[model samples]
Target: MDNSLAELDARVSGCRACPRLVDWREEVARTKRAAFADWTYWGRPVPGFGPPDASLLVIGLAPAAHGGNRTGRMFTGDRSGDVLYAALHEVGLASQPTSLSVDDGLTLYGVRVTSPVHCAPPDNKPTPWERDTCRPWLVTELKLLRPTLRAVVVLGAFGWQAALPAFAEAGWTVPRPRPAFSHGARIALESPTNNPLELFGCFHVSQRNTFTRRLTPEMLRNVLRTAAEAAGLPTRPYAG
Candidate 1:
């Protein structure tokens, strides 16, 4: 493993910032042991997966119950993740065909995916306190990734909120007037250190969004392509 990945793994394995999340994950692991008996629960914090020098960072809300919680990778083995990885692959960000598990040999090129709350929350919702507790890890990760990070794509409103502080800490003001979360909205800011950070917002690829037609694969692809272009990446032609 790379040094950054090793450090991330250690931090995630030893994370105890939120006792409730720790306990909750343990309970879920124990109760659902028969189902995931052979799986080793990271049970601590979850970290981003991709090259350390990735230019794009995709921030998500939290892990899905059977997705990252089980596969030990954010956005893996779940419906939402399916759409996400498919889009990533379509855009040439992903190396493998799909993201099913850690052992699936999947990799990201210029992008990486992470979440505000590392562990899977109950009912897929995390309390404000839990979000706060996990903020520092996000901060550290951003700092470590600052060298190559040029753009951040927040998957949902919640993710936008969770990522705001990190941008602020990096000295990126919300563009004089705050940048709000609206589908297809884009914002640009300079970090405190004067590093540029471009941001894009999009509705999550949840089942409800898909079933209700609130978010379509075409729309998500467009948003990503726009973000990539803004970040100085080669944009893929829109397939839709």
Candidate 2:
């Protein structure tokens, strides 16, 4: 199999390993949300979005049922994306503050956004078995990105837990017992052939977190900037 990102992404989009997830995503696409009734939903699995040579990677749990699953792009057409892209734009990592669709022309400077699970799961959650089953795709992505990848920002504990093992499989030396996930948590992972990878933890940009103020814009930007710097990528001055 080719190790190219494009090749891996094509394979990701075609995956039908999880029967439940495949059925759920397709069913959601067929039923269509009332708000998006006129739009064609991207019922297939979602792939990572960004340049192939990105230095920093943002890992989330999974695509939202009507968000990425509808727009065919990670984090597109959703409130969570609104919060995330805004912060990324403020910090100069993203070209725009909004990501409404795949053709919106939004771009990431030196950061890539992906999730452990590609398919949208029911209630925005995937079962443990589904997560494990989907792990190989993420591991392959990590391996392809390893050449220039230097830092990772994992959103939420689910992503954090899912990413560590992938990082290890992709060649980073994860510490024993694995580092626990918490907002603002940082850990250094060693690699035999590459520079050490800096890992940072942040709360998921879900509405539940942002609306409740558990994860503020400032907090999100702070983590992003720190990880960007660690990745050796320049960022714009903080707006606030």
Candidate 3:
């Protein structure tokens, strides 16, 4: 791990940006202690997953109840991660079929995934203060990863909103009418260095979305395929 990432990991492991959230998450973990007794409660913040030199960054809203909160890796040990890793594998971004745990031997080839709020908020909803406190980490990560970043795929509206300001700070203007969060909408912007950073918006692959057929595997795969294409990477067909 790079020094920056190491610093981020340390910060996340001891974050107390929001005392209410901290208390709430700990309470939830304690109540479910019997179920997850063996699990280590990060109980602080959650950091990004995958290599530091990745070309793609996947931004999500926050950690899930039993997913990232328990597993300590963003998008791990959850239903949403199941669909996400599957799509990542199909798009040649990940080296594994699924992400169930931190030590699952999963690896992202050219991509990384992270959430704006690292800790699991009560009811999966983070407060504005918590989001504000955590925004700097995302900005720092973007700056560190900018050299290699070619595309950023936001999982939902929250992710899009949190990430857009950073792009603007980097001198990227938002396009007219704005880019909406559909399954396959694409937005293009130039970084301060004049490198193009393609932004693709997709509905989150949450249980609510997938189980309700709001976002299907095919639709998610198509968004990733388009992102890969925009980044000048060859797209692979979805195996399923």
In the range 74-164, model 2's lDDT, one tens digit per residue, is 9999999999999999999999999999998998998999999999999988999999999998998888888899999999999999999
Q: How much does candidate 3 score in TM-score? A: 0.91
The reply for model 1, stretches above 4 Å from the true place, is: 1-5, 33-41
TM-score of 1: 0.91
lDDT of 2: 0.94
- Which scores greater on TM-score, model 2 or model 3? 2
**For model 1, how does the per-residue alpha-carbon lDDT over 1-240 read when each residue is reduced to its tens digit?**
224755975676567777777777767666664666777665545667877887888999988766777777888878898988888877767776478888898988788888888888888899998988887777777777787888989999888888888677655676655677888878887755756988999999889897798999888888887777766677556565
lDDT of each: 0.79, 0.94, 0.79
How many angstroms is residue 189 displaced in model 3 relative to the true structure, after the best TM-score fit? 1.2
Better of 1 and 2 by lDDT: 2
Q: Between candidates 2 and 3, which one is better according to lDDT? A: 2
Alpha-carbon deviation at 183 in model 2, angstroms: 0.3
TM-score of each: 0.91, 0.98, 0.91
